[model samples]
Target: MNLRANERLSERIMPRPHRRFIFSTLLLCTWLFIAGCAVDQKAEVDLYRRVLDGRVAATQPYVEGESLTLVRAMTLANQHNEQLGLRGEDYLQSLIAKNRAVANFLPTVSFQPSFTIEQRARDGAPSGSTGSNTTASGGSYQDSGKISYRTEAPIVGSMNLFRGGGDIANLQSADANIERQRLLLLDAQSTILLNVAQVYLQVLRSERAVEVLRNSVSLQEARLKDVKDQFANQLATKLAVAQTQAQVNGTRATLLQAQSDVRNGRHTLALLVGVDTINGKLSEQSVTDAVSDPKHTLTDYEQMALDRREDFAAARAAVVSARAQVDAAFAQYYPSVSLNVAGFLYREFYADASKWNAVLLANVPIFSAGVIEADVRSAWSRLRQAMLNESFVRRQVLNDVRTAFENLDAADRKTAEFEQQVQAAKEALDQARAAFANQLAINLDVLVAQDQVLNSELQLTGVRFDRAVFLLDLTRAIGVLPEVTMQAATRPATLPGLP
Candidate 1:
């Protein structure tokens, strides 16, 4: 019953018709402002599509199941890798930050219209007293208290006229952060390309291993058949047949493991390329046929890395951002200034009432209980940390160059050794076959030498694969993966409102 009574009371106090018009005007102004400033999702998506088309390489044929080439695999990874896409968001947000800093220089305007009703007892009146008080609008009430109305419809605005150069420092800091994010995005693209290439080579290596193992199995089966024929003619013992069958079984097991490695390697490559599975054959030409010596010395590679590495450039940008933050923090020791203005749309008629008014505000900071000092110290520490990180990144870049160069060098040396070993095994196999034809060597000797030759060839293939992968690694370590894979480096990303 009391709730019903309150509802009836509220209905009786519905806004006056003139006040409703004022409310509608405020609503319309707010809607217009929001509509003008809001981000359009469709436009943003279109922008993304256009920019992405120019940046990423096309891999339509590869995605539709063309055989997996390393170059195509890299193209697919650049288009579809989830982590690389996530890194792109950082670059996008940095552009938003750039716009936000730009907006700090603009004025903030709003419509602030109020229609307040006050119902209170008279001054010094007892609690729950029924006495009335004169209202602001000159009204008298006798129910439980006085009733009054106060209304205002004003357009207000404010702008930061000055802030001890802090605004300028903040804008500079934001610009530096933008450049840093762009460089990091480039680094991410290079990283993904190198990863895809590594996995692609892994699949190639496993496929080659499987091929070598299959060849070994075929040779072993041929020998087994020959031994069975000898046993049937009473020229070989049953124990000899059993021994030959055991060797064939062992070779089959090794062949199965090699086949499994091929499948597993392909699966990994598929995931890196963002595909559900990869069951196609890799190009045989992907194998390294001949390896050459390093084209540059270790010192030369190190210098290239230091000059071309994107993460190092990003680290240097971080130091600049930190220094700007320090300057902004110190600016708190100076004064700030701003301007505020208001124009009344619904003004009360009075002899001294003004249509509009403006006030200039200035704040001089004399003391802050050490708050400003603490901020300065924090900024200085961050600046120091950024400087140290830049130095550390430089060291790491050199280290990466040296490590990759050394690994490639060692792999090249092993290629020579493995080639010699393969040649010697082939020579031994030839001599053994000749001796067997002359009945001077046993059949088992000839078969054993042939197996040695095949094994040596397999080892040589593995060394060549290693050399190829390490060469790509050296290219990546020197920060040239983008140049080699995509034929161009990723450019700085930009968006709407970016300067």
Candidate 2:
């Protein structure tokens, strides 16, 4: 009986132990897999950070002047203006031309050496006295003047003259071109900065919109739960409950769209900030202020354009360049005077010694097949075109200024109106909620109030964002942005006309 009992115990205990061991092994493998996954996730996160170096770098250095706002980001982009490979290539080419221009003003020198060797003999006798006295019958004057030597020396100098100032004009043109590129680079920087700011602001607005929408959804969800509870208690009708549920579902769908907008806005910001095209994170400003409307006088705006706009300066420079080109064209009609100097040493085997010769020359062009006339015509046409373009840009800039100011004034008023609307809507929602709590209003009434509140919130957000956008446009129109070495974006303290 004891042996039988022991066998039974062993059978049960051995199977149980094997099962426990297998289970433990499986759990261990699973844990290893989860741990490995966590490590990989961390690595991917780090890789994304590395890819968005520009955005990350923008926020670093512990924050300096103006806290490195989006405006400063624009300035930074300008300072770090890079256009794929074109800008660098342009810079390099300009540098080469500049170096060549500098070299042209310096002296030019060269070295040359020539030698002549030959074996010669006169038919009867050599031209010298000794050769004439030699016997000619001795095997056809066996005196072969086989002389060979090398002349080792060099001569070098330089000369400059009045060539209708063509070289000067060329150098001037190069300098102007460099200036033009510099201005263009400034313009590029401004554009990139504007893009970054716009995208960054969009992301901020989208995020806020998402948060506000989420709050709305939560509020609706709470109302839906209350309506369901009331319907169960027969205090609220089924229709009212169904309406609340439908509203909640609709809010959820809208929430999804807002989230998508946020994601896309962040992606756009990443692209503008030079963030890697791959996976990257976007950092944005956290601003919660009422958008304000500001008005600027026309005179002030025009002054701002003249003083701070790089485009205006560039246009003016173009006019100067056109005038210079006209001068260069006219200069072609004049004669060019160039002084030339050349020196050489000549050596011959037949001569007793080497000979040296030096010469100076002057040249002028007295006639041409109307090439100068054609050039003058081209230059005049260019000048006229440039003048027209300048006028057009100026008019456009002034119009932009006027439009921006008007928009700013309008945005401020709209923001104020919307702010009032939002406040009234909030009050209405509160009253409806209170009435429903007291059983004086149905669930449908409360849901409608909630929807109104949500709509008002959305409207308010849009108005605020538009105000900001208009402000940016106004600043740009006045050309105050590019002239600003640093950015100081002033967030308004309160809504216009708000207490």
Candidate 3:
């Protein structure tokens, strides 16, 4: 009985011809709201998943205070890195912008209830007549001073059928922007990876440098002591002892500087991994291959980078988005159509403007004081800027690949030269030791030959370190650092052009 009464009340309140419109509009709005919420929820899930991964990565299998690996550093950075987290927020913002663009192509519903008051019939007939207007013959008795009021409560809904392609363009632009942010995050990841690896390797390299210089200092000290002993025996000159002391001082100075570099490298690594300090031994891992040669040719690397580089792809997407904006701006020159409907719940002093009303509104732009023209021109300017950026990024991608490829080749060549130098130094050192054992050469000659051999090996090691850094650079330039390293900087691509 209650349900039937409610039906009759609804039918009486809104004409049967339009009652379904009210229910359908409500459902549409509800669905749209739910969809928007779902989009937000999805973005949240994605962002925090990386955060979780970073936390989990911190729990490594290595013994505490023993080593910090590249994998561990990257995972921790992905979570704790403020800059990357901020970029993730940018991704969320783009999602929201897309939501706003979507709303343009959807309907809106609102409830408005209002009350009004008015003064009526205040004119007096002949001021001296004295209340004659309030006589029995007077109608409505306005001279007696009365008030009038009105009330209306309505549920309104509106939907845009067409405007310009601006809605779709804005949507496309938002989609492109999302890709751009994601690619930027990936690029940042690769860059941070390079920095961490460099710093980590540098710390180890500087430590090795310190060790080498310390050994040289020790050798010089021993030689200086021998020179002092011989001078006391009147076998060596005082000048020889002074020169050996000078050599020891110089080597010690260099060793001090190398130790400083090691400390600085540790500080940099700590900062890069988003920690206050890296408080432990860093396990060494070689990032180089035994045979350092590009599987692909130089030309191939250049072309491949243009395709694989995330930033370059992002720049291209920006151009597509900007072009869409141009079309959207042109859309403003066209007419727009919309539908507005209202269902009045109750009314006072509005019996004639009764239960329901609807208006199909169309706005034709005959003139706008050059506003649309200005908009179109501005959009075109933006498109031109995007195109220019895309070109610069394309060249940059090619250059990165070419530069790393060439540098690796040079390092490889240096490797050969340094190896030969080391071999020759070792042969000389052997001859010096043999000659000294036979009493044919002085102790100073043997010390000098050993120093030369040590320096040669150090140079060879340096060449190998340079080869490793260049190999890592080539990996980064190709935009596969995360992939080849087995660490993820981003999720799967969301758009068509992204790979």
TM-score of each: 0.84, 0.69, 0.79
Q: Which pairs of residues clash in candidate 1, taking residues 3 or more apart in a chain or in different chains?
A: none
Report how far off residue 352 is in candidate 1 (Å): 6.9
Task: Name the weakest run of 10 consecutive residues (lDDT summed) in model 2.
Answer: 132-141
lDDT string, candidate 1, 385-422, tens digits: 99999999999888888888888888889999999999
Identify the candidate with maximal TM-score: 1
lDDT at residue 167 of model 2 (Cα atoms): 63
Stretches of candidate 1 exceeding 4 Å from the true structure: 1-15, 33-38, 41-56, 61-64, 120-146, 237-243, 285-294, 350-352, 437-439, 488-499
- Give the clashing pairs for model 3: none
> Tens digit of lDDT per residue, candidate 2, span 1-499?
9998987654433334444544565576688679866635455333323322322233332122223345545534443334512443454465457678667666565544433223334443444322321223221112223322233233555555555766676577667665655554444455565566666667667777888989998888888898888889988888998898899899999989888987787556545544433133333442222223343467777776666555666676677667667777877766655444434433222244324434454456567788888998998898798788778878877888788778777887988988998899889989998998998987778888888888888888887777676676666666544333232344443212211
TM-score-sorted candidate list, best first: 1, 3, 2
**Candidate 3 deviant stretches above 4 angstroms:** 1-45, 48-66, 117-147, 289-294, 349-353, 433-451, 487-499
Which wins on lDDT, candidate 1 or candidate 2? Answer: 1
Could you give me the TM-score of model 2 versus the true structure? 0.69
